[model samples]
Target: MNKHGIISLGEVIVDLIATDLSNTTFQRLLGGATVNVAVGVSRHGIPSYYLCKLGSDESSEFVKGQLTKEKVDLSFCSYDFNKEICSVYIHLNELGERYFHSYVNETPDEWITAEELDLEPFQKSKLFYFGSGTLFHPIARKTTEQAIHYAREENLKIAFDTNIRLKRWESENQCRETILSFVQKADIVKMTEDELLFLTETDTIETGLEHMAKLEIPYLFVTRGKDGAYAIHKNKIEHVPGIPVNAIDTTGAGDAFMAALLSRFHDNGVPNNEAELTEYTEFANKAGALSATKLGAL
Candidate 1:
């Protein structure tokens, strides 16, 4: 029931990533967008709690070990002995583009229920972070809705990443509607350029910001990959140029960006003024660029 730091609610899984171009073998890595952010926050020496369910299998042990190594709080994380492990296969193309194949036909993460959640931590958390993928599942979707309602009732700051993984959802329209509803509830919303376009149905950045601003989300960030990121708030727009790096795999870059952004904001006391928000955004942009230099979600 700590009153500070962040709580990430979503799925946690093992990522089987091909280390070489031949694609014959792979290295098992711990990853999930929310889990990545949680790990990233812990790496920055921040207090973070990961809220999710995992199977009582080797993959689950691996995830717990990685999170423990990162110093993330696992008090709220559960291990279900009867559930199957959730896994993802990452295929990295020559162009550094990563494609995902999820092996979660019937998994524990997909069965998370609202009753299984403990609301005390979230009610007292300074920031509650979540995204779109988990909501694709019925139980997780309901649980997420309840968590959002509780966060709102407690006046806790909400940060949402519209990490739209189309293959995970039922339909594109459902994704947009679900994401937009969460966006309206979030005080800070971060999305890539494509995600923003998809959510807003706007062709231009100018029009996109206009649409997002109408949602009354105090701060909005649009990441442009290697080109860097942009921010919009109070009718002001600013662009932070990206740093050049010989890219390896571009996986988890956005989640890292969100984690860094939230950490910076939490460190800066949630940015009461425009100057503070600008400074936090710039710093986060740098953190994201730094993350891209790394090979994995770490």
Candidate 2:
């Protein structure tokens, strides 16, 4: 029961990314924000435990095989023959920006429940990381909340990423409320600039901060593509410049950043001072930028 590992709970799906803007040809890969973070952290030499229920299908096997190959621990995962893994078709623009085109989900109701979760991983892990993808479903949302409660009881650091997909939710208000509820319980929160604007209903980061002032999120990272990211800790904001790199695909850059940041925290502990924060964020920015230079997220 090592306390250095990270536990990530969320959906793992197949990503059908268009080879180009033509939208005719696609390359299938195993991807999901939380899944990317698990693999990315594992690559950083940290023990990453992934928690999910996989189905008895080819796509599910592919996802599981990829996770195994990535060196991520699947000891806490489950399997069901009745359910099939989800697939998402993503379209990319000339700038390598991704558009979530469509989703093919057969068993939306089939989610790993809290009762099914093994508490041993929670005891052995140092951090609990998750995203908003699973929160749109009532059953999965209950499971996520239960997991969060377990994480709190274990005194594990909780990190939440607002990997917002508007198409998944019933309404904007529900999305904001559901995400904000989880945000309040997190020790660390990561979001893209667009996600921040959407959640806060504000035009800019400055105004978004004003809207989020009362929530008092301990550490918030708002990433803005090549412009780098703004790291807000204890009311002090520092702009960490993005590392320069030849752009390719921006699929899982934020997940890369989150994984790097969490890996740094796992190794050296969370940065408490400005100097430490800068060094940690700079390291993460480099990882994120490097990830964008690749085609697939994994």
* Whole-model lDDT per candidate: 0.80, 0.90
Which candidate has the highest lDDT of all? 2
User: What is the overall TM-score of model 2 with all chains considered together?
Assistant: 0.93
Model 1 Cα RMSD, 1 decimal: 2.4
lDDT of 1 by residue, 1-298 (tens): 4577688998877788877766667899887799989988887777898888777777778877888888888887666787665777877688756667446545534556788888777765788899887877778889888888878887788888989889878788988998898788788899999988889898987788788878877888899988888877776788877878777757788887898898887776666776776777777777777777877877
Angstrom error of the Cα, residue 128, model 2: value is: 0.3
- Per-residue C-alpha lDDT of model 2 across residues 79-178, encoded as one tens digit per residue: 8898799999999888977787888999989999888888889999899999999899998898999999999999999999999988899999999999
TM-score attained by model 1: 0.91
In terms of TM-score, the best-performing candidate is: 2
